[model samples]
Target: MFPNLELVKMVADIENPTLFSHDLKSADILFLDLIVSGGNINTLADFIADIPILIITSAISRWQYPEFIKNREHFALQKPISLQMFQSCIEKAIQP
Candidate 1:
């Protein structure tokens, strides 16, 4: 399993992102999660023009967040995420 620090390192090497919105623009891969209630999901989605979004959440279904879940470029990363899963999500989202 990849450590959180390693994940951060991987992201760091790719490009420096100021906000979640900027990250989406610079990177083909984007991981969006709600550390709280997923309320920001819609806001983030709105900022993402065409980038794919990998969402991590404890919510069982997409209905939990209506605005963000309707996107085809979106993927769900259920909580208790594994390293392989996270990496795969990243790859899939970023792959052109």
Candidate 2:
């Protein structure tokens, strides 16, 4: 779908999340799964401060991450994501 985009997948080792870090400074966007990161969203959010992020979480209603909520560049998508919603979020995130 995103023909011009380059996607890189990284599996975070929950036991050692920091072990897989590799020059993410140049990445245009970040797709993160909150549950899989061992609830270390803040740390990862801070690391990619300037980049736009699409966060996936099962507990959408209970989410209280003010930092992400307040940022226009950050988007949260609930579990069982739909293609239309995903596409909309991607478009919004990439908008200037």
Candidate 3:
């Protein structure tokens, strides 16, 4: 658990367009926990267009995910990742 990291937002529903867009835009990193299929990519891409996304999963690598999402612009962080590693990832991701 990253006690030092401050979570700007965390949303469960992707359908609430107004709130979802607002929350995502305000966050530095997006922690998405879903297996994105072909049909789901377009809408999601729209909302997460400019944000850095971290796909949290128990899988070993991005290869385990669908080809569409794996090849897209995003990072995969295996579950049970350490606090130090998670913090390191956040730091690297937010850098300009």
TM-score of each: 0.53, 0.67, 0.61
User: Which tens-of-lDDT digit does each residue in 22-65 have in candidate 1?
Assistant: 54565544455544442433455555557644555444566765
Give the whole-model CA lDDT for all candidates, comma-separated.
0.52, 0.61, 0.62
Off by over 4 Å in 3: 1-5, 35-42, 52-60, 64-68
Give me the runs in candidate 2 sitting further than 4 Å from their true place: 37-39, 66-72
Against the true structure, whose TM-score is highest? Answer: 2
- Please, what are the lDDT tens digits per residue for candidate 2 over residues 7-73? 7757664444355445456667777665654455565655566654555544545445546544644
Instruction: Give me candidate 3's TM-score against the actual structure.
Output: 0.61
Residue pairs of candidate 2 with colliding backbone atoms: none
Tens digits of per-residue lDDT for model 3, 1-96 = 655467787655555456558777766667776644333534576676666555454445665655546656666568777777667777766667
Model 3: colliding residue pairs: none
Looking at model 2, residue 49 earns an lDDT score of 67
